[model samples]
Target: MPTISMTVNGKSVSGEAEGRTLLVSFLREELGLTGTHVGCDTSQCGACIVHVDGQSVKACTMFAAEAEGAQVTTIEGMANPDGSLGVIQQAFQDNHGLQCGFCTPGMVMTAADLLKNNPNPSEKEVREYLEGNLCRCTGYHNIVKSILAAAATMRGEQVAAE
Candidate 1:
């Protein structure tokens, strides 16, 4: 087992995991962070996406040991300290961006990272950035709207007019 340490959400965590243990498994099985879903074991599916060192990554594609000393943020960590959903999550809900909900976690995670890097993304940019995340429900129209709306909200703009 390899000793791995990282900050999850806002708390520091440390554990011993097998060298080959995927980050997704470590989060779900070891840390009980089930919000980061595993829709497809393959990396092709973005359901296992998370933030590592403030960047988005597919937990299924990385080993737990590799994340040592890195900051990790899973879907469960994206909410406010009081447990209320983040703005992006609220936007998804308000816009009905999710249907089956299986892909919502990853989508929200990716969207959060995207907005962090580009606070004011255009509609096309939102769609382009979300290309890696697949949603079998809602057909992505509302998803795009939700992302844009969330960006607006983050910028302190009113969504009621949009």
Candidate 2:
């Protein structure tokens, strides 16, 4: 086993892992950040998405060793410093963006990345950007609404009543 270290959730962390250990495993088992789900063993599901050096990546597709010295942000880190829900998260809650909740983490993470790059994404753009993240529940209607509302909120504009 090799010791892998990274800055996770703005904190330093290190743990021993086999070279083949997936980053999601290290984050879940070693660091106990289970918010990053593992709905699929393959990369088809975005359930295990996380931010690696500020870009969203599928954690299950990358090895723990590859994340050495990287800055990783899991779903658990998406909240405010005082632990309140962040803008995107609040939007999800307010908009009923989640049903079973299996895909909410990845959806939120992806939304964060999208909003980072494009602060005010149109409904079509939001839908297009979320193609990689599949949500079996809610039919994606509320999820898209959530992201758009989050974008509006992040831009400091008033969110119209739905």
Candidate 3:
């Protein structure tokens, strides 16, 4: 096993992993960061999404060795330093974006990436951006609304409650 060192959630972490170890496995089992879930091993579901060097990637699609020196951000890192919900997370709660919650982490990760590139996304763009993330519950209208609200809040605008 090779020892991999990476910055996870703004903390330096290192662990021994085999070449075939998935990033999600390393995160969950090795580091005990279970927020980055393993929804589908095939990468079709975006539940394992995390930001590697600020871009969202499916953890299931990469080997731990590939992430060895990268900066990884999981759902655990999305919170404010003071331990409050991050803007995106608060927006989801305010807008009722999640149901069952299995898909919320991936949705939040993907939304963060989308907002990083496009600070203000239209409803269509939010829907298009989230096509890769699937939610078995909450038919997606609320998710789209939540992302939009988060974008608005992140842009320093008021989030009018729905």
Which candidate comes out best when scored by lDDT? 2
Give every collision pair in model 3.
none
Error of 3 at 20 (Å): 0.3
lDDT of 2: 0.94
Model 1, span 1-162: residue lDDT tens:
677888899789987799899999999988888999998889876899999999999999999999988899999988888999889999999998999999999999999999999999999999999877888988999999999999999999987944
lDDT of 3 by residue, 1-162 (tens): 789999999999999999999999999999999988888788888989999999999999999889999999999999999999999999999989998899899999999999999998989999999988888899999999999999998899986585
Q: Write the per-residue lDDT of candidate 2 for residues 1-162, one digit (tens) a residue.
A: 789899999999999899899999999999999999998878987999999999999999999999999999999999999999999999999999999999999999999999999998999999998988988989999999999999999999998766
* Error at 94, model 1, angstroms: 0.4
Cα RMSD for candidates in order: 1.2, 0.7, 0.7
Give residue 57's lDDT in candidate 2 (0 to 100). 96
| Residue pairs clashing, model 2 | none
TM-score for each of the candidates = 0.96, 0.98, 0.98
Displacement of residue 89 (Cα, Å) in model 2 is 0.4
Per-candidate count of clashing residue pairs (backbone under 3 Å): 0, 0, 0
